[model samples]
Target chain A: MHLVLFILFGGLCVAGAVNLLLQRHPINSALSLIVVMTSLAVLYLLLGAEFLAAAQVIVYSGAIMVLFVFVIMLLNAGEEERTTGSKAAYLVGFPGAAALLGVLAFVFLSQKSALGNARLGSFLVTTSDLSRVLFRDLLLPFEVTSILILVAILGSVVLARKEQ
Target chain B: MNPLLTFLLLSILKVAVVLVIFLTAVAYTVLLERKVVGRIQNRWGPSRVGPFGLFQPLADGIKLFLKEDLMPTGVDRFLYLLAPMIALVAALLSIAVVPFGGGQTYKGVEIFDIADLNIGLLIILGITSIGVYGIALAGWSSNNKYSLLGSLRATAQVISYELALGLSLVGVVMRAGSLRLRDIVAVQSVHGMASWNVFGGFQFVAFFIYLMAAYAETNRAPFDLPEAETELTGGYHTEYSSMKFAMFFMAEYGNMIIVACVATLLFFGGATSPFGHLIPAFGGAIVQAILPVLWFVAKVLAFLFLYIWVRGTLPRFRYDQLMGFGWKFLLPLAIANIIVTSLVLAIHG
Candidate 1:
């Protein structure tokens, strides 16, 4: 049951993600991105990372997406046509897509080698254990990351301000 | 702790109770704000829809329920719908790791305590931090400039405050010497009311910073620049309506309660009474275990009331003021507190 559920959500997420590349409308792309996020959250649950799943839904699906939509509306890009990249854009994109697909196919074809021992993959970190890693071992990175965020915030505010 | 079984059951129950209480509180919080604000301005607050406007929130809820569910033309329909759910879910999920009660055991069957995950405090912070994505998504998907700005402001505010908020907790974590909220409370139980970390000089400064940043992180007043009514025009939820809007509002209050609960658990000692008096009086049997839970709830409610009181009393800060206070004031204060705490501990230990 869990495996089937995981597959279903995974498929939906993949489909939504692909749609983002193909869709012309920015708003539509934004909407599909949300689908991808929600589906990914579902996948997290199936993977037994319930806390992570919940966080994914809350952060990515909720606040992050909302910001994207807001930016879309704020820019008023509705009337504008989707930017068409030159042959150079596709030159870059197609190969990128192909490489991703190739890697995915290779993983699918060689599942045993790709996945390794099931037990190795099965190891799950409880929320508490993750917390310890974050608070103790990862303390410096965590603190630095927060400071980085503060800098980004100040920079954005400065950039967004109107000249006097 | 039955560990696994309690984890599952407690997760479900805590989510449900937090959801209901949070939703109800959101409804009343709106009404209370309106009424209180009205009184402040020499006007009656919600006097119409059911006795001193007690039914106001219900009326507002019904209106949101009955309103049309709008899916803007050409907008990202999926994301639009998902935004509110994300917000509500994120807001609600943080409550899980909060240790509301001590424990209840009867003949090998644990009755109440939620998952006794060893890292409860970390779980709470992780969940709350991730909850910001809901607000961010709401802004981006709406395709409205106002909403986008609101979301951005909210994101920046939350991310900024989250730093101070999380850093502020380091003192508590260090003092407790354990990341488990329950363990932290256990440590606090040693000193009783007088010595709760809130009173531990350096820890007290951290607590104040956390409290202020938490108000901002949760987007409460004086720091509610994202939803600044005068400029943003309802902010990120500008385009949101109906139950979706209701859910977002509930999520905000829910987040508020979660923060309050966490603050209580970390600093006040979860479920331990003002002086550990209740534990001895009740005896160390099941009842004694349960007393701590009651004390925890009472402490949490007190903080919630403080949230409301501040909302009632303070005027909202201007955007720059909000940012300056966070970066300039709270951030420095928190860093200093941490330094002081570390030095003191190092010297003493």
Candidate 2:
């Protein structure tokens, strides 16, 4: 069952990514991005990271993508011009892609035992357990990250505010 | 029966039953709103269709089904057609995680909700976030200025309110110490009304903030700037007609029901009776299964009535006022509520 779901959503993720590139309209591309994110969340679920899956959907696919779609819609950026590849692009692109793929495959092969048995797959981390890890074990990082976000928000507000 | 097959069949059956009941409730909620609002305005509402207009929804359904499905000129055909379905599917998906009755299993299958997940509340939040796409896409695809503006307003409003909505629930999550709807309810089951988050938990501020934010999130009245008929016509659904328009309508009412259900579960102890142990279990397994469900439905109905009541009495917010209220007032208040809740919990513990 898990394998079936993995194949289904994994295929969907790849298909959405391809569609995102092929789509001309900015809105259409944004929507395809949402599909890719949602499908990736399903993949996260297949690995039994339920909390991560929910966060992926809520924060990334749900919130961030809504902002992307909203901005695209508001701007009404017209469809992109269809352009064939430049002569220099097809030359360097293929080998670069191949090298990247090669590196990924090498890393996966090296990590096969750990991926098969432990943290990478077939383990459920309940919400409570995840919360403890975040609050207790990773408290400093979480607090620092939040403070960084607070600073960024304050900067944006200051920039946007008008002087009376 | 084989275990997997039994589970599959039972689940299909559960989904079918719950969906039918939910759609029926959505339909009647429209009738309920019209009737209640009419009475509030000193007029009769739809009394000719059946006994007290009970079959009015059936007539309305038939009318919508028979009406022409239109695709206006120069619209994005694919997203235009897909938008209402997206709206409806996202609206319906969250119910699978809301526990409507006891944690009872028959033949190794959960009998209350369809999918028994540990992250039920988060799943609902995620689905709601996705629900925004339906309205946003509807407006952008329509090729109409009114639709575009309406959807734009909706997108901004939803995004702003969503932060407050999610934060308001943190206090409840903190009190319950888990994300499961069942656990949230169980935390409030100890002394019934007293133990409810609003009363014993001293999270009334959170509850009120949740109520206002939820109202905005569902895009219902007072906060319903998206579809303000006075200015935006039909809003994001302006270009829709026939069953397509009805789909948006259903999605709106469906969202309203979800907001109500979540409020009931989080603050009012869900399907658990307010009377707690004052009322004994009255009958066999069937009755036991149904009693909590009855309590759940009654609370949801009360919330729905409150929805209609506010719609009738209150006026729509100006766009700027709506934005300011959500961001400046509600957001800070929700944060304050969270801080107070956490501090109290820490000190008491």
Across residues A1-164, which tens digit of lDDT does each residue of candidate 2 receive? 88888889999999999999998988888899998999999988888789999999999988999999999998899988988879778998989999999999999999998887543456888988888999999999999999999999999999999998
TM-score of chain A of each: 0.78, 0.88
By summed lDDT, the worst window of 10 consecutive residues in model 1 chain A runs over: A116-125
Predicted candidate 2 versus true structure: per-residue lDDT over B1-349, tens digit per residue:
7999999999999999999999999999999998999999999999999899989999999999999988889999999999999999999998999899999999988898898788999999999999999999999999999999999999999999999999999999999999989999999998789899889888899999899999998899999988989999979999999999999999999999999999999999999989888888789989988999999999999999999999999998888899899999999999999998899899997
Off by over 4 Å in 1: A1-164, B1-18, B28-56, B68-74, B105-113, B283-290
The ten-residue window of minimal lDDT in model 2 chain B covers B273-282
Tell me each candidate's i-RMS in Å: 4.9, 0.5
lDDT of 1 by residue, B1-349 (tens): 5766865675676567756765776677677668766776778977988778899888887788999977655555767787788788877766656666655554443344445665566567656755676777688778787888898899878866777887898888777777677778777776578667887434788889989989998898878888988898999998988788888988887787788788887777667777655344745576667676678767877887788778878899877888888889988888888888888888996
TM-score of chain B of each: 0.87, 0.98
